[model samples]
Target: MTSQPTPFVIGIDGPSGSGKSSVSRAVATQLGAGYLDTGAMYRALTWWCCHTEIDLGNAAAITRAAVELPLDIGDDPSAPTVVVDGTDVAEAIRTSEVSSLVSTVATVPEVRVEMQRRQRELIEQIAARHGSCVAEGRDVTTVIAPDAQVRILLTASEEARLRRRSLEVHGATDEAAIDATRDQVVRRDRDDSTVSQFTEAADGVSVVDTSDLDFEGSVAAVMALVDAARRR
Candidate 1:
């Protein structure tokens, strides 16, 4: 007789415009699991940094003050809400300006420590209720959810990723801006390279290149991996 499959955590990591967000959500929907965006937490802090005029270069100051930063993450999978200090910052956290600077604020060791703690706790709680999680971010698979039963690293060619980002935000309606935004993602990749330590090999990890698949297709790929893991 087949034993009951164990509930597990799924990690999806990739560079910007690699469809991590869209595909992760789709996979969560398919699996009926919770979705946590580790990047947005950093983005929220970045938003706070700019709004409060805090210098990003100082790690000590940021650490001491990081605890005071109000971060609210709602449980709704369809619409996860993020608020900082009572202000609804869900939309603000996704802006191009915030996106561009999030990595700067996130690279701080203190900030990563705090954020990583919160992310891990949140994942445990969500998995307890939902039975599993399909968490995605720059470091989810490698660092944040390294113990997750299933881990996947998703990526795509730079050019393809750029096109996807353009289409996601505005499609053909804003080709020039899409190209510009792609350049920003690339710059962010370069800036984040040194700070990122999320791709170190784990005992078992499935890496996929999403350069060819659309959003649904990528999600399907992740789900297939989950099925294989559950059967293991």
Candidate 2:
């Protein structure tokens, strides 16, 4: 008879467009675990702020929104959904407008605290329901889940990251598309780094560079790290 697989938390951190979202989802799917894209929480909050016309410049108001933010994030790796209040903002939050301003809401210290709190609660709840969970975001490995069983800092060269973001945001990888996406990807990294150290690996967290790895390769690499941790 086969033994039962151990339940664990896999914390993955990386800058935007480093394939953290895709890789984490694939890893969770392979392990039959739940997946949480913490970045989407920020993005959803940004969408809410915009929807309610709350001034993004008002740090206090943003924090208030974060505290009361009615977020319903699905845990299925195959059909991940993020619903805010009574509306589904999954696709809305990914818009260029939301992407450009999400860093603003995410940078507020109080907002971060509130969102991190929600993320931790969700992680525990998901892990309890599913066998395990793969939660990925800028601070997952450091702040969100420092004691996670498997912590990974996924990184890639600037050029590679730019190409991926260009394809994702604009559905193209041409020079013009990459140039257009540079501001969003580069500037967000600058702003997000102020609150979380995702560019570098924290203590006890492994680094996975996907500059040379394809999609399947990246997924396999993360899975390998998870497997190693499970054995230990």
User: Which segments of model 2 are wrong by more than 4 Å?
Assistant: 1-6
Candidate 2 lDDT over residue span 92-124, tens digit each: 999999989999999999999999999999999
Instruction: Identify the leading candidate in terms of lDDT.
Output: 2
TM-score of 2: 0.97
**What's the distance in Å from true for residue 227, model 2?**
0.9
User: Model 1, range 1-232, lDDT digits (tens) per residue?
Assistant: 9985455788888788888888887788778888888888888888888888888788777775567778887655678888888999989988878877787787787878888888898888888778888888877877788889888888888888778777766656366967677756787887776778443434577877888887777878888888988988
Cα error, residue 1 of model 1, in Å, equals 21
Which ten-residue region of model 1 has the weakest summed lDDT? 196-205
TM-scores of all candidate predictions against the true structure: 0.90, 0.97
Question: Could you tell me the lDDT of residue 112 within candidate 1?
Answer: 82
